[model samples]
Target: MSGPAMFSRYEFMIAWRYLRARRSEGGVSVMTWISLIGIALGVMALIATLAVRAGFRAEFVDTVLGANAHSTVYMVPQRIENDLTDEVYVVAGRIQDYDGMAQKVADLPGVTRAAAVVRGQVMASAHDKSNVAEVYGIGKADLEAMPRIVDPATLRGDVAQFGPGIAIGAGIARELSVSVGDKIRLIAPEGARTAFGTTPRVNSYEIGFIFNSGRYDVDRTRIYMPLDEAQSYFNREGVADEIEVFVDDPEQVADWTLPLLRTVGEGAQVWTWRDASSSFLAALDMEDDVMFVILSVLVLIASMNITSGLVMLVKNKGRDIGILRTMGLTEGAVLRVFFLCGAFTGVLGTIIGVILGVMLALNVESIMAGLNALTDGGAWQPEVRGIYRLPAELRAWDIFRAVGLSLTLSFIVTIFPARRAARMNPVEALRYE
Candidate 1:
């Protein structure tokens, strides 16, 4: 701002002239192009990978929270004694006053909703096909509250007459080759206790609705029944196996654990979503860190191309550098000129890469759909990936990291060649000429 500033007009003009010079005139034009393109590709790849990884993780967590309870309150097992025969046995404890308990839990602060649930494992059969299913007994109000299941956009059948029938997942329906109005038989191993022993409870119910939760495993094994019907089928009369509790912030379930425990009483225990899926989330985080390191190495390798190109340019322009030095150009000015040559290439390439990466991330889903159409549905498999399509989310932090890494590496690699040109001996450089 005061005197002649750094990177003055003359220095820029000299750098620009060198970058535009022909190969026959002592310029590494091809190497410059190669270095610029390499940097651009590397930066683009880094940004795209990070965006996809973030999107995938976010989507996976959302599906988990959407299709399942954030936390569940369960009655702990207790020991009981039979006075008639003087026999002592351990009986599975169940929430006796589930309606009142559910209401209490729901009324607690931070609790969004709480519903009594009767869950059991049963074998389902239809059209000579059988598969294991996990049945959930939920009230009509609770079912309606679950937007992921009863949402009009994804539900295939009517839930208006839900109590008398059952709601099955799309995967289960497909596996058993059954549709709406078809009767599906459910066989429970622990049914009514009789004189000899317990017998499997077998019952058939009409399929009332089909819902797609967009998760493969959930769709494959889940079955929903009305609360009263589930209670009768599971031999759980006037009681519930557990209370499924939802909260406004699932990630902060730990903060609400004490309150939930106090409300559920001493006989009950609270299990959180993190307890169920922590390992999977940890693995995803590890994968993201590894990917970042791998791509950073790619960017470094691309920046090395800048070093090689600049070194060649320094060697080719030794005589010109000598003349400039003899004509009163300072050593610092010579260094700045060569540095700008490499910096310009790196800066321009990084800008182009940023634009391309952001565009790709924002429209990744549409692009994936196009590719799937061209490849005959081979681009992505919902069953294998657990989601319907590829996802991408661009964040400001990821973009900054990519750009910073590219520019930093460019400047560092350019320094050595610039210093070499600055310290060249004018007499030796021009003696042969």
Candidate 2:
């Protein structure tokens, strides 16, 4: 322990000596441990939060796309030559050969399925309750082709063999107080234009199934019926308003969207899931960014603890620092020693935090489920809103960003204290001889 060569030749040795020494021997202070734990906690929180946000967004998008087509080729009337009349007219440009158009889109790469869809705004009334909903008149094959948002296993009755039946989302069912086998009346806005006035189309159909789509608006506003039945009721038999397309991966649906739109030719408007849900996706992205920034501030606060710990260490070990300087230890070496001490804390904490965070994020669903079970589901039931279970999608980039921010801020905050230690006067430090 009295070997001067190890202490003088290696700055790291001296740094370790200063940091690892017992309290009686003036080393390893309590503040250092607290600062380390703080950094770990901060990084852990950031990683888990980011993972949860990413997971929830992915799940929500999947759920939404399940209930909606990835892309839709709809008809929009070509502008009349110069519009000579002051006409506030609504045009229903039906897409002829809708099935053929859907097949064209399906033929394109990345496209999985396509279907002709007839959409209408309607009022659904049942059990003395009424709610405005979007009624989808989907072909039997198209309806079969559509992915299920509500697990098919959960349906009370047969959905595949639907016979003039209307499927309702959980929210709609709740609002109308209706369920499977119940009848709901739909009032369509489009009808015969008589000399006296426009007639509203009305029809009633038995509920085939109740779908829990896990989407706030879709659950509340989506209703489904057979294409033939819907067309007959709406007076548009053998014609679909739009052709909807589905892709293998909805996230990268752009690869299929443009070409499909082109396939349908000029004046044909194509709508992708991204186009329809842009606002919702954009808002989610903004919230995620804001959360990242907010959590970074917490890391910065934890980094300050690194500064505090280093400062306290420098103060307590002033004499040792001066004695080391009196030996062959240069100011730069002294600077490095303190720097390593703080840097070590940051690195170690970051490692542990990342590991802990990743583990927690990966198992968030099971962990939440376990907690709910322990508390008899009461703990989480009330909080369940669109998504009933917690989801966590661990992304390496998110973890790297969190750790990078923590370590960078931690290292930067250590500089001042390290500089102070390096500048300590040996004369004053060892004065009371």
Best TM-score among the predictions, by candidate number: 1
| TM agreement with the true structure for every prediction | 0.93, 0.84
Candidate 2: residue 253 lDDT (0-100) = 77
Compared with the true structure, what per-residue lDDT tens digits does model 2 show for residues 292-402? 999999889888888888887888788888898898677877888899889988998898889889988989988888898899986556225465666899988998899
- lDDT (Cα atoms) of all candidates against the true structure: 0.90, 0.81
User: In model 1, how large is the Cα lDDT of residue 70?
Assistant: 91
- TM-score of predicted model 2? 0.84
Colliding residue pairs in candidate 1: none
Residue 134 miss distance in model 1 (angstroms): 0.5
- Which ranges of candidate 2 are over 4 A from the true structure? 1-17, 20-28, 78-89, 192-198, 255-257, 359-390, 423-425
List the lowest-lDDT window of 10 residues for candidate 1.
Answer: 21-30
Q: Candidate 2 local accuracy as lDDT?
A: 0.81
Model 1: per-residue Cα lDDT over 1-433, one tens digit each: 4545789999999999999968594448888888888899889998999999999988888777778899999988998889998988888879999999999999998898999999999999998999999999999888888777877898788988688788999999999999888999999998978999999999999999998887888889999999998999889999999999999998898887889988888887889989888898899899999999999898888888888888988999999999999998888999999999999989988998898888888888998999999998889888888877678989999999999999998899999999999999999999999
